[model samples]
Target: MSENELIERIKDRNPNEPEFLQAVEEVISSVSKVLKKHPEYHQLRILERMAEPERLISFRVNWLDDEGNVQVNRGFRVQMNSALGPYKGGLRFHPSVNQSILKFLAFEQIFKNALTGLPLGGGKGGSDFNPKGKSDNEIMRFCQAFMSELFRHIGHFTDVPAGDIGVGSREIGYMFGAYKKLQNDFTGVLTGKGPKWGGSAIRPEATGYGLVYFAENMLKSVDKEIKGKSCIVSGAGNVAQFTLEKLIQLGAKPVTVSDSGGFIYDEDGIDEEKLEHIKHIKNVSRGRISEYTEKYSNAEYTEVNSDDDFNPLWQTKAECVFPCATQNEINEKDAKHLTDNKIILLAEGANMPCTAEAIDVLQESKVLYSPGKASNAGGVGVSGLEMTQNRMGVYWTREEVDEKLKGIMKRIHDDCLETVETYELSDHNYMEAANIHGFLKVAEAMKAQGVV
Candidate 1:
């Protein structure tokens, strides 16, 4: 079947799964040229099989709250593909966790892992149990219960899960403890463990750091540098915090940072000291971005206005824009705002943070755009490094891990550029290059394995 036909079939099969279908359509459409060149992939129904998960494990997670009330939540693990190697991805724990979201993330993971040049395949698992507002004990109980059923399907050599969104060091610690107790063996079944417990030194910061590395490469391609570029970074979470750090390290003036509450615009730039304060506010105090204005009198904090069609966070005047927040945070209006403000570079630190219409606007404006799968693959790349370190039973120094990560990010950037030139695409379509190049690796592996 044709790519469009395959997408239509996917839509029909996955009703109400807009996220999943969107992901499949993006990849299928991006790699249409390669699919046409190699019709064997069509004959073997490669896209059809690739769109479907190998295993979809769903269960009810029951745990007691601090009030002694039994809370039940839906949990899911979508082992999307394992043709490259073992299944590897993060497990998110947010109220937004659903089959559609997980499937889309898993599908994106396939290409992301392939781009990393790692043996890891793609999979993602999570529960709809919001860790927010929950007591430590309650959160521990929930993680333990979530792992009770999840442990049966995951392992170091099978499916290695990490942390995402609401799942951080605390949550990973809880889940790792439960998995250890359940299996009665110590192994690297998880990647975001504490450093003393086998986690890599830079695992938490890899994604954000790698994003800056990718962005730097993009700027260099245009004969520009990040040193004096003004940047607006959304989301004050791990990705945003570290992205700011790296940007500052490169002498870039990152002027804004945001959370769900809204964004803070500091014209003086967010230096290392400001970033540290933000880390404490979000990671320790669990406070809102508005608290930033109290510390820095020059900064302005804007609250999220639901009636606004465009996110004010993206409207900030800047040369570089990094969307490190949740999916679809940047709508078409926001994209137009960024373009009107003369934004030169935009890269996603979060998965699919920009809507399709937003991406079109950026592309039409000739802005250098990098998709999350390639730009944010650093987190998973370091996770893959953590797996190697685990297998060797040794830890590398911080400098070593960071160096390796920089090399990987540079290689991925070059590969995407090469793919774009090879495909003769206009406007340096990194999204299409990333999708096609990433898909080719996995597709070859699947074909060699004889359609398993």
Candidate 2:
């Protein structure tokens, strides 16, 4: 079937899964050339199989709250593809967790892992249990309960899950403990463990750091440098905090960091000292970004106005923009705002943060845009390293991990560039180039292995 025909069928079958359909559409649209060149893929229904998950497991998670009340939530695991190697991805714990969101993330992970040149494949699991207002004990109980059923399907050589969004070291510790007891084994069935355990060095900072590395390479392609470039980074989470850190290390002036409350704009630039304060505020206190203004008098915090069509944070004038927040945070109006402000570079630190309309605006404006699959692959890349370390029963120093991560990000950036050049695409279509490159790798692997 043709690309459009397949997409229509997918939409018909998944009428309520907007996010999943959007993700599949983006990839299928970008790989038209590849599909035309490799008609065998059509004969074998490669795209059809790729769009469907190998397994979708859903269960009810019941745990006790601090009040001794039983709280029930839904959980899911979408083992999308494992053609490259084992199933690998993160477990997000948020109220927004759903099959559609997890499927979209898992589908994107397939290409992202392929781009990392890692043997890891793509899968994602999570629960709708919000950890926001839950007590530590309550969160622990929920994670333990979530993993009770999850442990049956995941393992070191099977599916290796990591942390995402609300699933941090604390959550991972709880889940790993539960998995260990349930399986009666100690293995790398999970990543993002506490450093003293099996976690790799720089795992928390990998995605954000890799984003900056990718952005630097994009700037270099245009004969420009990251130094002195003003940057606006959304999301004050792990990805945003470390992205700001690496940008500072590269001599860039990152002017903003944000959270769900809103964004904080520091015109004087967020230096190392400011970054430390942010880390302490978000990572330790779990406070809002507005608290940043209380600590720094020069900075101003703005609350997100839902009534408005565009986020005021994106209206900030800057040379670089990093959307490190959740998906679809940047809409059409925000994209136009960035283009009007002449933003030169954009690298996603979050998965699919830009809406389809936002992407179109950026592409039309000739902005250098890097998709999350390539730009944010660093976190998973390091997780893949953690898997290797667990199997070897050894650990690497921080320097070694960071150096290897840098090399991997550079290779991903160069590969995207080379693909765009080879396709003779107008301007630097990194988004399309990235999709095509990663897709080809997985498609070839699937073909070689024969239809499953």
Candidate 3:
């Protein structure tokens, strides 16, 4: 069947899975022609097989709140593919957690992990329990309850899960501890552990630092440099924080960072000192991004009004932007805003942060764009390194791990550029190159493994 027909079938099957369909459509739109070039793929029904998950696990999480009341939340794990190796991905805990969202994330993970060139497959798990305002005890209870079921499914060489979105070191620790308690055995069943334990160095900052490293390579390709450039970075989480930190380390002036509450645009660039404040606020206090204005008089905080068609954060003039906030945060209007403001590049730090329409706007405007699969593969790259360290019972220094991550990002960037050259595509068409290159490995592996 044709790629469009396969997409229509997917939509018909997953009628409510908009995010998963969007992800599949984005990838199929880029790689469909490439798939057509290999008739065996169509004959073997590879596209149809890939569109479906190998395993989709869902469970109910029950925990008690501090107020002596029982609370229940839904948890999920979408083991999308294991063509290359063990199932590897993240566990996100948020109010928006659902089967469709996890499936989208897991599907994206399959390609993102492929781009990293690591022996890891793709999977994602999460729950709808929001940890934003919950106390440590409440969060711990929820994590234990969630892990009690998840433990039965994951293993070191089977499925090594990590953190994402609402899942951080704290949540990972809680879940790992619970798993260890239940199994009565210690293994590398999870990544993103604390440094004192099995976690690798620079794991927390890998995604953000790798993003900058990838961005630098892309900029250099077009005879542009990041030094002295003004940048807009969205999201105040781990990825955004480290993106800001790395930009500062490289002498770039990052002017904005945002959270769900809103965005903060500091006319004065966010320096190391201000970043410390932000880390304390979000990591310690769990406060909103708007609290930034309370300490820094020079910073202006804008509350996000849902009624607005476009986010004002992207309107700020800058040489580049990183939308690390979440998926679909940048709509077509937001992309248009950046293009109109003369934005030079956009590297995604979050999965599928840009919609299809937004991508079209940016590409038409000739903006340098790299998708999350290639740009945000750093986190998984480091997680892969951590798994290695755990297996060998050895740990690498921070500088060693960072160097490895840099090399991985550079390799992914070069892979995209080479694919562009091979396909005779546009100079900066990293999206097509990335989707094609990433999908090639998984497709071949699936073909080799036969019609399972």
Per-residue accuracy of model 1 over 14-58 as CA lDDT, tens digit each: 999988887888898898889768999999888899999999999
lDDT of 1: 0.93
**Whole-model Cα lDDT per candidate?**
0.93, 0.93, 0.93
Off by over 4 Å in 2: none
Model 3 off-target regions past 4 Å?
A: none
For candidate 2, lDDT tens digit of each residue in 1-452? 98889999889887899899999999999999888888999999988899999999999999999989989999999999999999899999898999999999999999999999999899999999899878899999999999989999988888999999999889999999999999899999999988898889999989999999999999999999999999999998889989999999999999999887788899999999999999999888988888888889899988998788989999999999999989999999999999999999999999999999999999999999999999999999999999999999999999999999999999999999899888876778999999999899999999999977
